[model samples]
Target: MIREAIEAFASRSPSRFAILVFAAIIALFTILLSLPAASADGTATNFPDAFFTATSMVCVAGLTTVDMATHWSPLGNAFVFLATQIGALGVLTLASILGAIIAGRLGLRARLMAASDTNPLRLHAGPVAEGQAIRLGEIGGLLATVAISALVIEVGVAIAVLPSVLATGYGLAESLWYSIFYSAMAFTNTGVTPNVEGLTPFAHDYWFLLMLMFGVTLGSIGFPVLYALSRNFRRRAKWSLHVKLTIVAWSALWILGTIAFLLLEQSNGATFRNMNPGEQVFQSGFMSTMARSGGFALIPTSELDSASLFLTDMLMFIGGGSASTAGGIKVTTIAVLLLAAFAEARGRSSIEIFQRRIPGDVLRLAVSVLLWGAVTVALATIVLLTMTDAPFEFVLFDVISGFGTVGLSTGVTANLPDPGVYLMALVMFMGRVGTVTLAAALAVTQKGQLFTRPEERPIVG
Candidate 1:
């Protein structure tokens, strides 16, 4: 009976089904984390902390109320690792993958649902272009790419960082565990360090940080981009417009962020002031990369200048690519919006990028995502501000961090009251699943009108 009900729901709305699955997973992990075996001291954790940690893990948000390395038992760490891997697969994609595995093939409904994850326009009533992202017929291949690429990349990163872990004076077994944990966290963009010192030990280890940056970049680029690049690594001309735009926008943001950090934080003694020129550039690059959903922090976020914090907030809010493990409104949304603005400025009737025209629907969708994300962040920030006496900058930083699932906090998240904690968890969930998905889930149906209303223009801004 339960299976029947689930099938009914899945058929009705993939967005809601995905939300339900994520909520269920978070709940299960919360219960597991609350158990005595999940803690280091053999005592059951409190409800608030356990629930928040579980939500962070399942959302891949990485914000924690408790000390991650010292508070969790080996068993608890195992649970977290598993939860992050699941979270990285994404809710809808995971469901479709599981269904395909069980049935030995993806059904029509399953394919449609999974395709929606890649191209959200598929969720609404519309005719989505076959060349947009992943086609419905290619859903099986996309799922395979998602699973296989994640495994290969994580394993490769783990092997590359294993030597570094061993150099830290840990035994082979413990080193192996830490390497795998860090690899998983890096590739998933979860940023939850397995050690209490976090990235302190590896702050100067260029090789270790580079490997993590590589893993995080791959993870944040979105599975669709990976799938496309794998098939057309040498054939740039064959790349789809979506792939082109995502790559271009992502690279631009990374470069701009690096420059911004370099200029803004160079004089700040706590972060970049003491570093030599070369090291400063490298660390700035790392910080820029991490700001866009990588989440690992070498420097103290609380010590950053207000200007740098605000810049980091923007980077975190933009987050990573669409349909990626990373969060926020997505780079593509911003890219589309930017392209639309440029088109408007040029008095072009249509938005074009990479020599391909973008339909109005895509622009509308991008605007909707940006607005919804901004609203979500603003609302969360307001509620959090009211909940705590923390400074506005710190509150805003943590709120955007939660909303982006970027996990770089100004030490404010750990001190949030229970109400704020719950609110942040909800923000994380919304961020992970996406505002579009949530909106679609709430919507009853998309009504199609056969006739159009008379055109009217209101007063312009």
Candidate 2:
């Protein structure tokens, strides 16, 4: 009966399952965290703080109303780590894995839901195999591969960082633990640090920062890209245009952001004044990469120059790739939009990339995602500005950070009023699922036009 109900509910719509899965995880964590045992002093965590923390962790946003180090007990931290892992893996993917494990099979509706929840864009790009049910063995195999690959990457990163952590004067056991925690946090792009100073001590440590940067980049580059690269390594398979576009866009954005940060913050006494040239370059690169939904910061976000902050806001909005742990409008969406603009500027009728023409629907969807994201952030900025006396820049930064799931803040998160916290929480939720998916989830039902209307043109800008 329980399984039947789940199947029925999942059949209703993919968004329902995705939303419910995240909702369940958040609720469970919220209850667990609200217990007195979850706190350091044995005092119960208030509902507001618990809810906000739980939402942030489950969404992998990493924003905190209270410090994890000072306020939360070991048990609470464990809960947060688990929730972050779940969020990073994705609610739908994890849920499907669990279902496959327990039932030894996934129903047709379950597979469809899993696919839709993880990559709805794929469904749009291709047709589902007609009258063919997805095999349970196939899903189980894929799930196993993804899970083992992720574990291996994370564990390898931990081992690599362990020595550097010990060099910092941390005790052996503590260093080992911290290395593992940092590896997990980096790969998940949660940006939450168990360390009190939040990675500040190792800002100039080459090995530590490099390893973390690699981990963050690998995780946020999207799993599909990784899988494709892996397959190509073994079989020399042809690369899809999607894979090419993602890599190109990701690399371009990282380079552009790094240069922008370096130029903007070169003379900012608070951040880059004392740093040596090499250290500044590394820090600038790290910040550039992290700003695009990785969430780690070497320099204090508050100390960044206005230009650097504004540039960061744009990077955070563009975000990482689709179907990855990272959030924002996604690299592919930005790439598509840019391609469209370039095509229009060249007086071309179709947007062509790598000799492939982008479908009209795909372009439309990309525009919708970008527009919706902008509107959401704008509205959030207005709300935060009206509710608090915080600076406009800080409020705007916080809003975009939440919506990007990047977790970088300008020191305003902890002081936000209750209403503001809740508002940010909502933004985090939407971001985790994605602006497009959230829009789909809120839709009443899927409907298509039965007849075409005559096309008309409106006045141009």
For model 1, what is the C-alpha lDDT against the true structure?
Answer: 0.90
Please give the distance, in angstroms, between residue 107's alpha carbon in candidate 1 and its true position after superposition: 0.6
- List all candidate RMSDs to the true structure: 1.2, 2.8
Superpose all Cα atoms of candidate 2 onto the true structure and report the RMSD in Å to 1 decimal. Answer: 2.8
Q: Candidate 2 residues 28-109, lDDT tens each? A: 9999999999999999999889999999988888789999877988898889888888888765666565555545677654
- lDDT, candidates in the order shown: 0.90, 0.80
Estimated TM-score per prediction? Answer: 0.98, 0.94
Per candidate, the number of residue pairs that clash is 0, 0
Candidate 1, 1-461: lDDT as tens digits: 76566667787887888888889899999999999999999999999999999999989999999999999999999999999999999877977766555556678878877888888898885337658688887888898899899999999999999998888888999899999999999989999999877888788789999999999999998999999999999999988888888899999999999999999998898888888999989988999999999889998899999999999999999999887889888899999988888988999999887778889888898999999999999999998998888899999999999999998999889999999999999999999998988999999987878998999999987
